[model samples]
Target: MSLIYEARSSSSLLVAGVARGLTTQGGRLVRPAENCWHMVVVRQGGEASMRLVGPWTGAGVASYGEGAEILWIRFRLGTFMPGQPVTGLRDQETLLPAATGHSVWLNDAAWPLPGIDDVDAFVERLRRAGVLTHDPLVQDLLHEPGSGLAPRTERHRLLRATGLPLRHIRQVERAQQAAALLGQGVPIPETMFRLGYFDQPHLTRALRRWVGHTPGQLLRAGEEHLPLRTRPLDAPSLH
Candidate 1:
């Protein structure tokens, strides 16, 4: 895995107690097969695809529109009750999913979901409605937990325990161009093109979701520090 992870989350009024973070490409993340939930607003570029290799879930191996890039608007969901067969994604622009109360699942797409465009405005509108709230863990994550992500030693247990899927196991096979161009502080449009994303908006949205911060915001945040694995954007990927 060679992705640069910058986790920043602010309290918004839409998702109440939920927090958002950003993760940049360069590494790998492997998710388990359990009945978990996620509200993911993701974007894709190049030949990227997301899949779920498990049983007892909704769709698996979901491929988006084949463009150089694709943007996403998603959310993390949990079980409202003890056992409800995980189902399809939400199609409308409503802030009822998080408000309805579920479990905390990130990047796992086995529950209510929407597209990049659909949930984009919805998040903004919900902020106006005083719905989501930022989480407080952003500060420590900003330090880039030197230990890395939590290891899933109990996949079978969690699968037997939850029934959906675990967080998508991110495998850092490609260095999506965002890390490259953004490293130079280039305008998002050029970076977007370099990353194969459809446009600036798509790139920006992904930056916010995975990395928990925008491209420029990340650059600014790192102005006073250096990463343990820091290297130039033009450098070759480490995977």
Candidate 2:
């Protein structure tokens, strides 16, 4: 059987989005590189597990078990858990220990496994408890680079908060924009010019590395391209 997936936008500033997937039979899916990280909960065979997934820089394949249900809380860039530094989480995951059937150990306490409807409240609790935070400077610097901090300090803070350098994050974001445009039937030359890619091959290579599909493939793939959210081409930040 094929896996079913759904996603919804979140109102919380700390959250980028939320998504859930279910698999009746085991299968592999193409997971695209992401600009932000996520906290994922998986249920299989009557057991539940919570894991912190980090930002990915390249395309990868993820395997799901038969009869698996997964929920992902995709956090915004620069939001991270205190003590569970995002730096060490790049391209990897940290599986939290189960404190009980309904909760897991995080930041020295039990955090209940949240259902789909409870995500916002759960994140609010983490923020109140000092387990979740956002680095405003890092996010601000990315937009226009006028934080007033020394170059070295800014670099350190960026790496610590997002687990990738400024350039990589921008590149990933750009590639995602390109993919979204191509998927929406925009011509290749138009996409290249709109997003500031040097040429068609430059756009193609970036898409292949980050989106796991070439321009033509993305046009053909449509909404079935990746498991993550496809950003809007007109999003103000992309320009």
Candidate 3:
């Protein structure tokens, strides 16, 4: 069975999607978005039976499983592969960017990257570091998602300093804090108290506006990408 494993974009410099346990017959996808830079990883889970269908068409795909459950992951950096066209043009394209608060599907020619080996191995380094799955609350931010995303197109002046749009930095930071807290399974009521919201409703509004979903939705999205791990909630002082 072929399916998208997970998809999500945080208020950070990363946007990601993953697929696992695809059918032996390799699948194709046409992406119609301008991803400044990103990585694509392919991991072998079981029954190494798949192949790329276009562009570098007929190229022999790497084999994983049996001898070893091969995990392949691709890394695409915004600065590195600036607007690299998606090659293996397919018929279906269904992806949406979480930030920018807008989404579009391309009817134009979509070029996707060719094949590769184990996607998991690429992430193994992050796994070992206390960084990957290390922070639980990164996803349960207490502020608004829309607050930061609306003004953060790389075309801004102030955003460059804060690494995010200044018009919405404070809100994004708060939401980031809340996301971190939620990942630890911290109760929402208590989080509201800690974040100084008038009530759950107030926080809920912020969550919806800034993050594109409720706190629970943020956590689920993170979980779908990878199991969130816990850590000390030493958020920076709100000076």
Candidate 4:
């Protein structure tokens, strides 16, 4: 795997992180299940294109072309487009039509494709245009389950904003925690106990479903194949 991947924390409220990489030789990677949505820009053969990838429900394989340059913008949960409900994009992708070599069509407007250095500014423009927004209701529910809102309303708001059930997000988060622990040389039983899993089998199942790797595989596999978490987006060093 000749993949050179480097991700950094973002200071933007609407973004979780930004990753820029080069796939020197075409290869596949294990993409873990995620609650947050993403926008990916690819530049190869002197052609640029963009795509909106919805929140993934499970682990899968992602392929890249040789010498492909990639910039991935991961949006924080609860951030969404106004008219384009994320519900319809779950587990799928929408390819943004190219307006020019350097821009794409979004909301019937010509939006410039963002380079890695200018992504924060691009996101700010989206916010100013009312094209991207964050839902406080969803954030509140995620932070505190015992919200004042009715159960039905909470579910509706969560689904509408993130296109994912609360339970699904929790499961994915737990699985990620487990993967992090296991990758750091923690024992399986200890990881299970620390994370409140029932047993080894339970931990194994969760990892396989959400992380695409069993506990054993995570320990044995190289870091290149692991779908791992980057640094927190609010880390002071990032700013």
Model 4 per-residue lDDT tens digits across residues 1-239: 35666687777899999987777678677788988999999998899999999799999988888878889999999999987888877898889999999899998899989987799999999999999999888778777856887899889888988999899999999999999888887888899989999988999999999999999987666353443334433433321
Candidate 2 — which residues are off by over 4 angstroms? Answer: 226-239
Model 3 spans > 4 angstroms off: 1-164, 196-198, 215-239
Candidate 2 TM-score versus the reference: 0.91
| Clashing residue pairs for model 2 | none
* TM-scores for the candidates: 0.23, 0.91, 0.32, 0.92
Better of 2 and 3 by lDDT: 2
Q: Name model 1 segments beyond 4 Å from true.
A: 13-28, 33-36, 43-86, 89-239
Give each model's whole-structure lDDT.
0.34, 0.84, 0.34, 0.85
Q: 103-132, model 2: which lDDT tens digit per residue?
A: 999989999999767899999999999999
List the candidates ranked by lDDT, beginning with the highest: 4, 2, 3, 1
lDDT (10s digit) by residue, model 1, range 34-78: 222333333344222222222212221232232222222222232
- Please give the lDDT score for candidate 2: 0.84
lDDT of 3 by residue, 75-178 (tens): 22211111223331221122322222221212222223223222344334333442222211222222334324334343232222112222344565466577
The lDDT of model 1 is 0.34
lDDT of 2 at 6: 66
Better of 1 and 4 by TM-score: 4
